[model samples]
Target: MKVKGHCLCEKVEFSISVESKRFDACHCSMCLRWGGGPALTVEAENGVDFADEAFVKVYSSSQWAERGFCSHCGTHLFYRLKEGNFWNVPLGVLEDRNSFEFSTQIFVDHKLGNYDFANKTKMMTEEDVLKAFGAET
Candidate 1:
């Protein structure tokens, strides 16, 4: 499905022209710290465009990861890195959030004990996540 998303203030907006069901979440420290727990993420198939450059603040959170948020309201948007060739976009920022089906939960080992995903989602260890993404966190 075609998905469009914007920041909390609607000043920044973007559209993704691909199937949204491919989105996933990550529980790694960097992602959790930047996005307040599991980061709802997806790979922008072609690419994403910013409605306004000033709307998002990019923070280099780690050696391999960086995060983006709305500067106006501090709405966390994405956690991305140079993953070979693809960039990870936060699924929550998509306008049509329901279009995506959250399947796997990555980096379960680094997740805090207070939070849990014991229902049905696949919980992946750091090694498994890195292996699936073809990179190490």
Candidate 2:
């Protein structure tokens, strides 16, 4: 499905191609520090189309992935893998939020004691995530 959304200030708008409404919450340390909580995201294939790309600032968060946000309002946008043209876009930023489900939780071992979700999701530990992506565990 194709979804459209904008940043907090609306200075940055985008349209991305996604597979389903089901999203995942990442509890990795990098994700927690980036958004002050779990990064709820939906997988988007290929890439995203930004209205004005200048407003989107990207940070190389890891060797294989990077994060993008609105430079103006600092709204967390997407976490993109450098290879395979894959993107994990924040669900909160998507315009049509209906019918979305919390499906998985990645890096479950890195989750802190401060918060958690009640829904029973398919939790994957750091090792599982790394192995699934063919990365070094």
Candidate 3:
């Protein structure tokens, strides 16, 4: 399916093709802080192609992850890692909200104390997450 996404201000938009079942939610600390919870991330092998550079700003969140957002509105765009070329796009940013479904949950160990996952989404550790994407960190 062709997944379409845009920033909150609509200044930045993008399109990518991905399998529905490949979508995942990440509960890592940086992801949680970035999205205020689990970051609904989908791997785009082709990476994100920005509609405009005026709105997109990148933040080096860590040695492993760098976050991108709208410079005008601060809308989180994508989270990137050096080890993986795939851009992790947030599901909430998609124009077609129902275009994807949660396939798995990563970093369950780092998830918040009050929240718990009820669905059948597979939970994995930091190692599993990094290994899945071939990331060392």
Candidate 4:
């Protein structure tokens, strides 16, 4: 499916072709610090095209992944794998929120006790995430 989205200030806009409607949540420390909570994201592994690219700033958050956001509004955009063009766009930015399914949660061990989801999701720990992404633990 092709989904359209934009940043808070509307300075950065994008259209992504996604293969699945399933979304995942990341509860790693960095993600928590970045968004003050788990990042709910949808796999946009097929392709993505951005407009007003100059307003977007990408931060290399880890050795294997980078996070993108709007420089003007500081709205979180997407997290992308460095090895490939694989991208995970934040669910909050998408125009339509009714179609996606919560399928997985990564860094599950790091998730805090204060909040929980009712959804039965596939949970992965840090080590599992590393292995699944071909990264060193």
Candidate 5:
């Protein structure tokens, strides 16, 4: 399915194709510190078309991943891998966030102990995630 979305100020608009409405909550430390909460993202590894590309800033958060945001509104947009052209867009920035269903929680070992979600999601610990990504453990 194709979905359209934009940043808070609407300065950065994009349309991406999604295979499913399943999204994941990343509970890694980097994710928590990035937005003060788990990053809820849906994979959109291909066909991401941006309208105002100039308004989007890409920050290399890690050796393997880069994070994109709207320079105008500071709205976190996407997490992209340097290799494989992999992308995980933040669900909150999508126009149809309500359609997505919770499917997984990555970095479960690092999730904040202060709160828990009511939804039952497949949990992946840090080691599991690292192994899956072939990232350093």
Candidate 6:
């Protein structure tokens, strides 16, 4: 599927080619702290292209990954793997959010106690996430 989206200030716009209509939520400490809650994202493993790259700023949040946001609006754009073409884009930024399905949650063990989702998602703990991504815990 191809999805188009823009930043809150409309200064940054992008389009992504995704293989699935499914999205995942990340409950890791970094993710939660970055967004002030779980980071609900959709994988754009196929490709992503930005219309106004200058409006976007990327922060190297980790050794293996980087996070991007709109410089003008501070809207989170994506969390991307530095070594690959894979990108996890925030679901809220997408124009057609109604078609996406919540399929999984990563770093489930790090999820806070204050909230929970009713969806039947495949949950993976921090350890599982580390192993899946070949990262040291």
In order, candidate lDDTs are: 0.74, 0.89, 0.80, 0.89, 0.90, 0.91
Candidate 6 lDDT for residue 26: 92
lDDT, model 1, position 49: 71
Q: Give all TM-scores, in the order shown.
A: 0.83, 0.94, 0.88, 0.92, 0.95, 0.94
- Residues 1-137, candidate 2, lDDT per residue (tens digit)? 79998899999999988777799999988998989988899888768888889889999999888999999999988899888888888999999866689899999999998778999999999999889988774
Residue-by-residue lDDT tens digits, candidate 6, 1-137: 68998899999999998888999999999998999999999999665699879989999998888999999899999999888788889999999888999999998898899999999999999889779878776
- Flag regions of model 4 displaced more than 4 Å: none
Off by over 4 Å in 5: none
Per-residue C-alpha lDDT of model 1 across residues 28-134, encoded as one tens digit per residue? 78777666677878777666677677778888887777777888988776666645445667777887777677677888788789977654777789899778768
Task: Give one digit per residue, the lDDT tens place, for model 3 in 26-101.
Answer: 8888887777888887877678877677888899998777889999888888888766575888877887767566
TM-score of 6: 0.94
Q: lDDT at 20 for candidate 1?
A: 48
- What would the per-residue lDDT of candidate 5 be over residues 8-116, giving only the tens digit for each residue? 9998999988999989999998999999899999999594699779999999998888999999899998998888878999999899999999999998888889999
Write the residue-wise lDDT of candidate 4 on 20-129 in tens digits: 77889999999999999999998886656897699989999988889999999999998987887788889999987678989999999999999998999999999998
For model 2 the local lDDT of residue 133 reads 83
When summed lDDT is taken over every stretch of 10 residues in candidate 4, the lowest stretch is 43-52
Where in model 2 is the C-alpha error above 4 Å?
none
What shift in Å separates residue 33 of candidate 6 from its native position after superposition?
0.8
Which 10 consecutive positions of candidate 2 have the poorest summed lDDT?
93-102
